[model samples]
Target: MKNKSLTFRIFINTFLVGTLIYFVCAFMFFGNLYTYFEEQLFNELESESIFLEDYVLNGDLLKLQNLETKNRITLIHSNGSVYFDNTVSFEEMENHALRSEFLGAKDKGVSKVSRYSSTMTEKTLYFAKLLSNGDVLRISCNQHSVWVLVLGMSQILLLILVIAVIISGISASWISQKIVHPLNSINLDEPESSDVYEELKPFTKRIAEENFEKAQREEIRAQYTANVSHELKTPLTSISGFAEILMQGGTDPKITVDFSKSIYDEAQRMTTLVNDIIKLSKLDEKSIAMEKEALSLRSICREVMEVLSASAKTKNLSLNLEGDSGLINGVEPVIYEMIYNLVDNAIKYNKIDGSVNIKIQEIQNFAGDRNKVILSVSDTGIGIPYSERERIFERFYRIDKSRSRSLGGTGLGLSIVKHASKYHNASMLVTSEEGKGSTFTVVFEI
Candidate 1:
């Protein structure tokens, strides 16, 4: 119903209102017109009665009997006998003293009365006046009631209503168009400058905002495509060049071992990159099935630390754990992945013999209703610059691209941590300074 055009709705509403008004006016007009016509008939009868009384005073009884008129005239004696009647014989007519109009005239000098005939088709109005000679002169006429009059004019009234409906329809359509024209003319691309109703300003502004956001998303998508193509091409070229060298029979025993090892490393790096891309894609699309439950943050952190202990040992770094049991409700696999990535990044970017400290403690939440678990990985390594801290969580964004590639870093580790944190409804806070150390803390609501 809301999808209907404004013109159609307006036309229907106006037509219905017009019909209602027409009925009301018709009822009132017919009623008042009938009453006015009855009053005028009574006045005419009264004047004729007065004239007959004058003729009787002048002894012109013969003229009363021969009066040429449509109305019926009657003359009554003071003793209640009918002396003369124009429409009927005086001997056959009933006595006039008991008549309502005659009795009214005896008391008031002049009066009128109306009654419907037995057939109910005609109504008779009787007006009577008292003469100076102690006689009553009466005049009567027949008229119709308001309802009968209305029935006779019904066809003409119906025709008028039909004409009114057509006019109302055209007027309603014009009004609806005038009201909607401003809305139709608005330019969505430049909503601020468009001439529109004040009530519609918010809607137009929202459209403009959404268009800008869509454009930004498209730009980001284009940049991501180019980055993915370049990243994949680099490893493919390395593998191809090494295979060509081996095919040419360039075999120095020591160099052959080195080339084969380099080829294997490149293959492994590409595999890792592909896997990370797939994982990021699943996280981005929110397709990863999550079964939430209470999990021990301390245990997950300890398990990740044990797995990376050998890698830390190669650089002679101390991987230590602090604090106690920290419980939070989250998907176990996601929690495990988040911890593993943070710990891995800490170890990978740390200087040799540097210490990596993992802390699991509970603190009062911002709302102060319950305790929230805080898992932090702090490292004594080359810290990030303040300006680059925020961008580090973006996929494939690296502050030092050449050094990051040399270290076999895919640059998606921190991005995964960010996505996991969001999925778990946690917050990631990083504090780092150049040439010093950095701390990455994740606060999870319990």
Candidate 2:
């Protein structure tokens, strides 16, 4: 049933329900039929008894033979002597003194008894009454036993059941088709446009929303592809132009050397851009092998600062690391890369003599009073506007495109930081006021 299709399951369910209903109706009909037959049997006995007693009082005992074909009429004397018998000779007739119906009639004026015959295949119903001549009048009728009666009707019941099964199967197939046709006809690409059952409206709307989102993602990918081509072409064109100049034989040796140098610089920029793009692709595919170990957050931050100190010095920015030691479980290189990008961006965007503060501290949980770790970088740089903050983490996005290009910074640095933070199950919080300073905080729940 777990692997069965919906149509088959629906068919089975409908058939089962129909079968139950059929049995219930059959039981009720059989009950009423049995009751009606029993009542008719009793009425026949009563009418035969009344007719025989009336005939005997009129002194027409010879007419008793007329009723022999319908029922057995017996005459018994008060002293238990068999006076007249219709089905047998008077000598062979059994004594009626000890018979249930006879004894009952003598005491109660009228009585009836039903008993199985000697062969057990037949039953006889006897009705007896006290007549005006002080004689007991008895009428007996033979019929099939109750078990035989049930067996006789079994053939008819089996036929009805077979017909019911055919009808139920047909109905089940028709109903299952009616239920499954609309689902099969639904257009997945534009689900809401299809007219289906009212019960399926919610599912169709959900599919529509997912398709819309998928379309938007495809459009974004197209734009990103165009951006990557444009970004790569600029440097490649510059390098090609300079190489062409060198190849054509420059008039001065110094000028030729300058051209070679310019070509090298453009080539390096293109190489960096291509490498960053590869890294972004790897991150998107989640292909990086990660090993978790307990790491000192403060030490990683210090190492990032040391590597970027020369860049910070050139910018005339004061780089500082302050806070307590905090331990976290993460991939060491990924954490270092995350911190390096943040500090590098701080120095690149800061004004001369601006301060870049690194804070590593343990955060206390408000609900459970548990201790967690946080690493924050605060920079007195040209901060981002509120509108651009959300898009800043998107690949190839920039607040100041020209300035970002001039700084020799790949737009993927912040994107890498975001991916790395997410890999460690960390949350990034940003606070910035344009023309003031920005603080980027990475909270780790280790």
Candidate 3:
């Protein structure tokens, strides 16, 4: 569907409203003018009737015959006979006894009435008075009806309407332009800084926020690409050098076996790195469609301990599991991976004879409602520095790069933990003191 221009809509609305108002005012003005004219005509007729009444009373009726007037004059006898008429012969005129004006004047001394012609194009006003001599005096005048008056002045009215239309069109166009100019001038690059209408502030603010997020995402992508390239290149270089040594002949069998093992170790490191990258990508894109189910956090912690028991033993670290069997709804694999990474990191970074304590428990609010299930891994190890804690969850971000690589730490473990916790609608909190211990906590809403 095609969108219509805002300016066009505004103009049409303005023009229609102005035109309607104009017509309404014009109708009211003309209607009042017609009424005023009728009233004036009646007053004149009343004055004339008063002046001629004395002449009839003095028996000087013949003198009224010479009176010059545009109005029609009539004198009627008490018995309903028309004795005198200025515009028509009295003998041919109809009797005035049955007339409303004449009958009203006989009863009330004075009266007036208006009558319209059959075509309604003409009107006649009649004023009648009762005389002292048992006779009635009547005066009348012809007038154009309100419709006829309007028709007579139609040209002037039409000219005024045309002028109003032209003025309205100009005003509408100016108003529409004034309203739209601000919107067109907005700068999208700095939408929030643009001087825009107050109503449009929220719209501009949203755009600004989206632009900021887009820039951050672009920066992160570039950094991630660089990190992936460097990480892959290191393992590939070591494997290539070791494989070349093995291919050479006439070497000691024991040395050959050692070189081949070195090549295998590098390949295994590369495989782990590739797998971690794929998992992070899937979590980021939300492509993992695993269904959620009820699972115990303590059970998952025990499984992780079993898998890393040998690694813990090698470090002379004691792995302990305590607290309640915290149960939550989540994907099993994601939950297991997150716990496994946390425990493995704890064992790797712990001091000899130091403990890696894993705890799972459900916490309740003051209202006695279960609020969240918490899984915490606390290690008595060389802890993280406060400044480096924030960056630990970033991929390929290692606090001690040389030591991390020597311990077979991929540096993506915490990043994976972060993504998995987020997938389960969980939050992570870290608290540590250098050279003492560190604790990582994941809180899941129940």
Query: Tens digit of lDDT per residue, candidate 2, span 8-41?
Result: 9899999999988999998788668765766677
Which ranges of candidate 1 are over 4 A from the true structure?
1-7, 28-32, 35-39, 42-142, 172-198, 363-371
Best by TM-score: 2
The models' CA-based lDDT, in order, is 0.86, 0.86, 0.91
Ten-residue stretch with the least lDDT total in model 3: 361-370
Question: Which candidate comes out best when scored by lDDT?
Answer: 3
Off by over 4 Å in 3: 1-4, 46-50, 63-68, 74-120, 126-138, 159-163, 244-255, 364-370
lDDT accuracy of residue 296 in candidate 3: 94
Backbone clashes in candidate 2 total: 0
Superposed by TM-score, candidate 3 places the C-alpha of residue 356 at a distance from the truth, in angstroms, of 1.3
Residue 43 miss distance in model 1 (angstroms): 4.4
Candidate 2 stretches greater than 4 Å from native: 16-31, 55-69, 74-123, 126-138, 145-163, 287-289
Better of 1 and 3 by lDDT: 3
